[model samples]
Target: MSNPAISYAHITRVTDTLVTATEDALAAEEPLEIRLVHNGQQQSITVTMRSPGQDEELAAGFLFTEGIITRYPEIKTIHYNNNVATITLQPGITPALQPAQRNFLANASCGVCGKTDLDAIFAPVKKTITNIKVPAAILHDLPALLRGQQAVFDNTGGLHAAALFDTAGNLLHIREDIGRHNAVDKLIGAALKQELPFSQYGLLLSGRAGFELIQKAAVAGIPVIAAVGAPSSLAVKMAKEWNITLIGFLREGRFNIYHGQEKIAL
Candidate 1:
């Protein structure tokens, strides 16, 4: 299926003495209303501006990662109407019943800006195994691997990507989006659909590691997350709390282990 959220366009640069035209890709950022329904009643919950494609996965992953839905069976169905997306829960499923101590609704550009309280942001992450270990060399080579897979970024230079790799440095899956968090969601959704053992693999992101990204990885049971850029303070803290290995500044055969260094071997 063609994703309506992204497209290619010719960008023209005009100057007094010269004119240049080049093809550029645009990332779509529009409001997606996520509604929840049970029985026959519906409630309009949150609206997020996210890149198109993988709307269903975005919804499912968002809810699951946010503690809205604990099990995959809790989500009955997810439907998207152009820009508006709705999620239907199975009978007796209620995310708000626990009094969602955090407000997750916010702009897609920054996932942690809209939370009203710190506890909401610091909610306990799901448990995961820690037996997996990856070579430090895999982190060194990931940037090139992710770059090779980003066809749209090569053309437009405007998309973010998340890739899953095994301990052997083999690429298992990849997803791209205008918003980094959305890209992670797409990747997770793809893995969930394939019944891939996510907790056994490492996650590589193309952008800086943030709190929301770490939270998503933790919820998905990903034991290790490596980023091509720096990690925020909150991201490091969350990773430590969730027992996840967080690595940053991954380039040129060297990386800094901000938390959980035992998972990466030299």
Candidate 2:
């Protein structure tokens, strides 16, 4: 069976006066429209271009992380029309929650670019995570753990990844995508599907820790976020505001803690 999330391609390389053509594979991205229905009234909420598999989980995670719906019971059923690549969510029960201050429009390349406003970018959270500390040794070993589970990136080198790990440094879940934010969403979605409590876990990213990534982690009640790459200034600011532990440039047994250092056992 062919996987809709991946595609094969060919590429030509010329190096040192040698030209070679090789067969390769790449991740596929397609428009996925998420439609919401309440009391049988349908409303098209947002359209996102994402890797094709796990449509239902993606939608569930997106809604949950965006603060659109809190409990899984709020979502009745999710269906995808493969013909149009559109997903519809049936809210069987009336949603007592209001629409997000801003809607989301995501692409395969960037996740933070589609937001409508700053307030929406910095949505308020009700709970604050405290007194959770991870050993510095775990920070040093995280990249190796993340690298070992990246089966897709190992094969295609075309996808980013996000992983969740326990305090003991055991990898719980890892998700890959053409976009970094999508990867995080997939991980969050998987966690939500499993009904796992994420308050005690931390997030690890294969790429830079950006503002959107931090926001998503915070929404999911993930207390700590560690990235193998650098973080933007805004990402740091939001982490501080949200009381999230932000770590970046995590490599070579060293890392920088940008905020919420109380959670890091130095």
Candidate 3:
């Protein structure tokens, strides 16, 4: 049995003047068409290129985060075949497919943005917690902590990760995918399955913070988002609007705070 998320490829390695032919592991990328079945009618909702594992979670997470369906019960059954994930909705439950989602397509690098449908995305719970007070020490340690758990990334040096951590800095869970957005969806899906509280945990992204990723976090009600890479301008704005903390360039013993100091002590 081989890792479904990894594909083997032949490559040539060059160092200084030496050349060696070798076989290398690559992050797999394949199309996953998410279809919706409701009211006795089925339709392809969106297509995303993603790693091959966790297709079921990816489907549910995509629907929830995309604001197509609210709770997990809206889905009657989820089945995957030939790389197509079909989500059969519970009878009498209608999908809230946004205007753009009907024609959405996402590649492994950037998931099709949901900004256009922001006003219609699922409304997250409104709540408050003031005891988290994360310190600089905890923030600084997150990169190494998350990096250590990236099993496939250790082998392929590819794939993005999304992890959840308690404010005390304890790792909750993590998901990896060729697409960062997909990784987030997978994590959220797992949390949904496990009935974990999203607002109580912090989210970490392995790559730069993009608007769509922020949108996904907001939809899930995640309170803070930290990324090892830079954040887009719109991402910062969204964080501000949501009152969520946004940290970027979060490595090398340093991180920049872009919004929300309520949860950070220093």
State which candidate has the highest lDDT: 3
Clash count for candidate 2 is 0
Candidate 1 lDDT, tens digit per residue, 132-223? 98988767888898899887677557888998999999889888878888888778877876668888899999989998899889988999
Please tell me which model should have the higher lDDT, number 1 or number 2. Answer: 1
The local distance difference test score of model 2 is 0.79
Among all windows of 10 consecutive residues in model 2, the one with the lowest summed lDDT is: 83-92
Tens digits of per-residue lDDT for model 3 on 231-253?
99988987888878899999998
In candidate 3, clashing pairs total 0
Candidate maximizing TM-score: 3
Residue pairs in collision within model 3: none
Q: Given candidate 3, what's the lDDT at residue 191?
A: 88
Candidate 1 Cα deviation (angstroms), residue 183: 1.3
Cα-based lDDT at residue 30, candidate 2:
79
lDDT for each residue of candidate 2 in 37-63, tens digit (9 for 90 to 100): 777677766677787777787777877
Q: What is the C-alpha lDDT of each candidate?
A: 0.80, 0.79, 0.85
Candidate with better TM-score, 1 vs 3: 3
Candidate 2 similarity to native, TM-score: 0.90
